[model samples]
Target: MKSIIFIETTKSGSSREAIKTADRLGFYTVLFTERPNFMAKREEFPDVHFMKLCDLSDMNVLQKEVKALILKGIEVSAIVSYVDPHSYTACTLADHFNLNHFSTEGMKNIQNKIQSRELLKNSSVTPEYWTVVTKAECKELEPKIKNKFPLVMKSPKSTGSKDVYKVGNLIEYRKRYNTLSTLYENQPILIEEYLPEPQYLVEVVVHKGKVHIMAIIKQDIQYNRRFIVMGYKLLLNPGVRFSNGLMKAIKEIVAKHGLETGPCHLELRRKGNQWKLIEINARISGAGMNNMIKAAYGINLVEEMLKMALGNDPDLTPKFQKNVYMQYVTVEKKGTLEKVTGKRKALASQGVVEVYVKPRKGSVITPPLSMGHRYAYVTAVGNTAIEAEANAKKAAAEIQFWIKESPKEKITTVIQ
Candidate 1:
């Protein structure tokens, strides 16, 4: 049987779904991961043919592992990863094996914010940005951007909304810069002009330089300490004129950056009458995106991406189309999760299709500092966007998290 290798996977979401898809397609599936806890639960992944523990950060270690598999007569068909820097690692390994996948340069362009922004600096889609490596550089650039308050500061490699900060003034800018510099240590920080509300996520599939706009999701974001995506609504029909303009922009961006094949998701914001590029990722979006897309369009994106990795043309035709909405469950305070109640009720609610809750009992939970803080989600469908959204929210409200506040300890001093 032909084999496919997965470099690392998210605890939940598209990555895990891809592995299951590959197994169902009858390919020998092998997983290399650093999480022993995940590997220990072998019974959970019965479809996986092999699971090996390895230092995923070391390419030499991965090379040796693949060589051992080859010695055992495993015919490797494709190497895939949904997370980065493992995504970049997978592309490099595909090149080493002469397999079909995205170019490492293209992946890097998508992975590195600074590189992508610099490459598309002259384009209309490019947002105004400045790169800083130190507090001195931030100070030097501050005067130039004095009037541009409410800018965003972030590490080039940050993901999942971590290490991204929105500052309203010079004091906030310097404070955020110090925090990021301390976290990254000599890595360049990108400060970009903050785009206002009405952002959209474009899920794209490109094959042999042809771009396919599979789904356009309108995002509902809540601004707290970080940008928290509270919900998503898939636009079943985004109109021909709007779709055409978005397609034209996406095509130009993909061609200019050389992302000739594979799956990519772009985050764009509406500025006046035009859409501006926020960032691009070289993988299908995580966090129930696959589920949302499948519910809305009846297209399995993860399966399609797996097929593409194995040098097969994907079937992108929509089997059906409907309005779908997803709402995330989050807490407003920090405490220990004692229990989660109402899953059955939420699942049984009208129009609710899926209800998933993460975080085991006694796990610490906090408000949205990043996407990880979201512990549960409810997906629902309707004949209209408002109906879908209302149904999702109604179901989400049925589920509740019971958390216990941590007790404060009193300190005692002894005098001798």
Candidate 2:
């Protein structure tokens, strides 16, 4: 029998769900996670294996040890990484093993924000205005860019909404830029015209150059400094034309950019009757959004991505059971955890599937308004979209979080 090696850094939903998929795929799953305390849910399963990976970025060392493992009777057929940064190493390792995989060179186009914008703009999938910021360069290009109120400034290589900020005028822009420069130490930033409207998330799965629209997810986002997605629901019934002129445009762009395999998650917004592409991700969306799609639609995209990596034909079915929502219980603000109630009651409610809590009593939690700070998430599924939304909202409201005067930082992670 073959084996699957999952490459992950942190123990987020992606890490846990990767293990679950490995079990479903009937392969001996080996989890390579970052150093000490890589929460191995091995106790929940008898077949899966977990290994602490010290440094996955060191490709030369990793390749040598991986080759040795294969020689020592470990049948690792595919390497998988859902996280974007680790994707580079995953693709390189797969290439070294002569395994089917996405190109590391192509990953270069996705990891760097500037490159991705250029690619999208060239294909006409991007908005009209975009600028790159450096401590030495932003001032020179300021005059060229239209100083529209509520402009967005963000790190070129960031996920979630950690360093994303919206500024109204020059004073606010300079202040925010100074703060970020002090904190991030001169990382290149992206400045763009903000599109104020409802955002739609499109997840597409590809196998052997065939693209399948996996799900149309409606995002519920919170505006702190920038847009941070709190939760989402799979909109089975879309009023908007999903497969019209817009889809054809995106398909051509993806093909032109040579993103022929794997799963692609993109964010778009409808502004005054026109759809605009925001950004595209070469990997799975963070926060187990793909798993929610799997629960609603019978398409196991994680499994499909794995199958594609193994050079096997994937089952891309259009079968979908409507009315399901995936919600992540998020931290609202920085505070000391004093109370958490009604969890038991909410779990007992209909359509409430799972609850995963990271912070306990006395654990200081940061509100998820920013990508840098999110406590935990709650996921629920229902019979209809209304039922699903209602159930999730009920659960969210029922659970109360009491804060203390002074809170400490306990959980540290990116919003994604």
TM-score of each: 0.95, 0.88
lDDT of each: 0.86, 0.69
Q: How accurate is candidate 2 locally (lDDT)?
A: 0.69
- Least accurate 10 contiguous residues by lDDT in model 2: 406-415
lDDT of 1 by residue, 1-416 (tens): 68999988877788988988889988899999998988888787887889999998788999899989999999999999987667778988888888856666777788877888988998988888999997789889988888998899999888888888999999999999889999999999999999986889999999878899999999888887899888898998889888888888898788767788878899998687577898899899987999889998899999998888888899999999889999988886788887778889989988888888988898998877888888889999998998999899988887777777733421111101
Candidate 2 local Cα displacement, residue 296, angstroms: 1.5
Predicted structure 1: lDDT: 0.86
Model 1 bad stretches (over 4 Å): 406-416
lDDT per residue as tens, model 2, 125-201: 56765564575566665666545767888777667777778878877777777867777675666777788888888
True lDDT of residue 17, candidate 1 = 88
